[model samples]
Target: MTKRIVILGGGTGGTLAANRLRRALDAEYEITVVDRDDDHVYQPGLLFVPFGLAQADDLVRSRHRQLHDGIAYLGSGVDRVDTEADRVHLADGGVLDYDVLIIATGARLVPEETDGLTGPGWMTKAFSFYDLEGATALARTLEEFDGGRLVVNVVDMPIKCPVAPLEFCFLADWYFQERGIRDQVRLTYVTPLDGAFTKPVASRTLSGMLQDKGIELVTEFNTGEVDGEAGKLISFDGREVEFDLAVVVPAHGGAECIERSWGLGDALGFVPTDEHTLQSKARDNIFVIGDAAAIPTSKAGSVTHFEGEVLTRNVARFLAGEELDASFDGHTNCFIESGFGKALLIDFNYDTEPLPGHYPSAVGLPLLAESRLNHLGKLMFAWLYWHSLLPGRDLPGVSTAMPRAGKRFETR
Candidate 1:
């Protein structure tokens, strides 16, 4: 009898893991991927959509078509995981029994968690670019805005693409400049973090950029409510920031199914897993990857790609009754758009911070430095995502571990 492997969520992590596992395992294993729908969105493209750089149609594709032919694809929402019974219950009254399970359901934006965020002026005065509809609605909002206090607030931390709020600010500056109303717009970036970003060095660099663009930085702001009718963002500390137009990144949480699955997740619905091994702490036969795992890392697509490499290997080892490799180092790399056809690339792992140098090779694209070449690389990623990343094809010269060969470390 062939062993069964069930993967939840047919997004980036699930699709890549399914394809990679199919290629690695022999005919003795059956791979199945479950998702709620057929739409596989290129999430990074959402940033470009509001700026008219990319379209909604260009960002989505058939999730079922991305998987390998031998892999089974189920278009249904998951109800819960019966870990003790070694089975999964689906919303459509179906049950899938598996010898091994992989959870890659990813994070969800809960706008309703914030008071008045989705009420009154939603899609009119306030908006979010985290989803396709929100991005499209915001595009129209930005187009007609003449000027005034344009505030971008991050409701909480651990949101998907931590750098995206900063990217929006940068692009907004460029957009206003292009329209010859740069001076009319007063841009303010409000975040709960004490700095512009999570990392210190990068935060300082980004903070300086914000100042250069004449954008105000409001840090240590814990949002209490978004009075959309009044166009004010109130923080828990009694501080308030008023806005004529507000772009908010709502609080993110794990899928509801994870919480419904008893003893399968943390308080936030994120699965607790061995950070390095990617195996669930709740059960030995279960694995967690991407944003679904409660790991101290950026919940970005690049992180998912790195996790897939280690996760697929570990899953194969587990099925063969071998010791799993605890080798994942929270490796992540992202291209930060700084607008005006320029961008910055940052590569870092568990112990290393992003440094100024070249990446992959001594002569490769400059790291932690803005350049037009990096912007081009950012655009090229959309092509790579569908053709290489999702297909589980190895990107040339890129490895699972963060490379130190070309990085320049700063002396403390």
Candidate 2:
């Protein structure tokens, strides 16, 4: 008798989970992955795409190729999950039965939620780097503009790569300087959050960086509408931020299929899972990982990477009839690119804000401090992502748990 493991959404989490589980599980357990297509975009690269540092072709690769040899890949859109029957329904009228189900469907951008955002100026003056098409179009737009009000706005929170917006601002500063128009472009950052970031220490650090770069920061502006013809982002309280060019990080939600499945997800279609255990609240035999999990964390690749490691062991333990491990500590880390060839690193878990100090200790890569070496590390990550990260090879020093050293632990 063989066990069936069906993983949905072959993005970062799904792909990595399939590969690692295939290596760990025997021939008696069959692993199958379901996704819409084979196009896997190196999502972080999209930030650079608009600035010409990356290309559409460079960022996308065949998703099926990233999986292990034995893992079965189904490149079709999912329709719904018959959790009661222990099966998944496909959009094209196919079905998949599983002894264990893993939801790694991640998230999708909802641009239409904002009035007039996806209207006339979309992809022309208003754009996003959250996806491949938006990044490609914004790249062309940025290359042609000499100088204007370039406003980067976050429509809401719980979005992917939370630091990416700040990185864009930093890179914009560098981009304009290189083009000899640094003084001409007026850069503004608008977010629904009260500060530059969710983490207190990182927010103070990043907010100061915005000030240093002459990027105006507007906080707590809940967007009401985008008056594209008038070139303004109007907040619900009638506050308006005018912009000649807008790079909007729109609201994000989990896959629609997750929503269609009753009691499987939250209002945003994200799976309500045990934050530590990664077990779906709706079913005992189902687990959720990555962005799809409705966890109070940034939906970033690093988080997905960490979740995969912990989830793999738990899945195996479940099959072996053991107690579930509650070791996943909402662990996540990100590199903050702060332009001028400098970057900062931050590491923390659910209960900790990004602190200043060396990671893994008080003396490794300086955290919350801008360094050129960290910038090099940031650039080198694209290579590491393709060759090391997706392959599930454990880096010697980078542990899944957030480190406590090298942080300025003072109160905000």
Candidate 3:
């Protein structure tokens, strides 16, 4: 009997994992990918939409077209997973039996979790660039406004592409400068964290940039409520930030199906897995990847790309009844877009923080430093994401492991 592999979610991790697994396994293994829809969104493009750099149509493609010919694609919502019986239940009452299962159903933004966020003035005084609709709506809103107190608030942490909120503020500053209303617009960055970013060095560097850009940074703000009608963000500590226009990155949680499936995930619906091996702690036959896994790392596409390399190999080892490679070191790389057509690149892992050096080589793009070259590289990533990354083609010289050769470490 041929072994069956069922993958949930056809986004970056699922798409790449399906394609790579198809190439690695023989023709006997049956591989199938399930997603709620056919739309494969380039999520990073959402950041550019509000600034008029990218459009909603330009960032999306058919999910079916991205997968290999032999791989089966199912367009249906997941109901739950029966790990004991090794079966996946679809929302449409279809059941799929699999020898192996992969969970790649990435994080879901829960705006409803925040009080008064989706209430009155939503899509008008308040918006989020995380979703396509929110981005496009914000574009129109930004065009009509000449000046106001524009605030960008991140409701909670573990949000996708953690640096995107900062990038928005940076771009907003440039956008207003170009519009000749730089003095009129008062920009503020509100976050739940104590700094501009998660890591200390990166936080200091980013906070300085915010100061230079005249964007006020409000830290340790645990948002309790969004009084949209009053245009205020109330914190749990009785503090409040008033805003004329608010762009909020809402609280994010895992997919509903994960919650529906008993013993599959945490309260937030994120799967608990061995951080390095990507194997679900709940079951050995199951694997988790991308934002779906509760890993202490940045939930970015680059992280997904790096995870795919390790995940595919681990899946192969599991099928072969061999020892799994626990080499994934929380490797994450992010291009932080600053104003004036410049960007900064940071590469790090669990053991190392992002330091000043070159990436991939001793003389590559400057690390932890803003440059036009990095901005161009950031733009070039969209092309790479669609063409090479999703197709499971290895990016030359970029390994799953963070290379220390070109990185400069500071001795504390």
Per-residue lDDT tens digits for candidate 2, residues 1-412, read 9999999999889988888898889989999999998899899889889988888898888999999788999989999999999999999999999999999999989999999999998888899999999999999999999988999999988799999998999999999999999999999999999999998888999999999989999999999899888999999999999999999999999999999998898999999999998999999899998999998888989999988888999999999999999989988888998878899998888999888878778777878889998888888888888787888777678888876666667744
Tens digits of per-residue lDDT, candidate 1, 1-412, equal: 8999999999999999999999999988999999999999999999988888899998999999999889999999999999999999999999999999999999999999998999998999999999999999999889999989999999998899899999999999999999999999999999999999988878888999999999999999999899999999999889999999999999999999999999999988899999999999999999998899999888989999999988999999999899999999999899999999999998888888877789987889998889999999999999999999999988998998989888888621
After superposition, which runs of candidate 3 have C-alpha atoms over 4 Å from their true positions? Answer: none
User: Which residue pairs collide, candidate 3?
Assistant: none
User: What pairs collide in candidate 1?
Assistant: none
Write candidate 3's Cα lDDT for 1-412 as tens digits. Answer: 7999999999999999999999999988999999999999999989999988888899999999999878999999999999999999999999999999999999999999998999998988999999989999999999888998999999998899999999999999999999999999999999999999988888888999999989999999999899999999999889999999999999999999999999999989999999999999999999998999999899999999999988999999999999999988999999999979999999999889888889987979989899999999999999999899999988987898988988888721
Candidate 2 colliding pairs:
356-406, 356-407, 356-408, 357-406, 358-406
Each prediction's Cα lDDT score? 0.94, 0.91, 0.94
Q: What's the CA RMSD for each of the models?
A: 0.8, 1.0, 0.8
Please list the residue runs of candidate 1 whose C-alpha ends up more than 4 Å from where it truly belongs after superposition. none
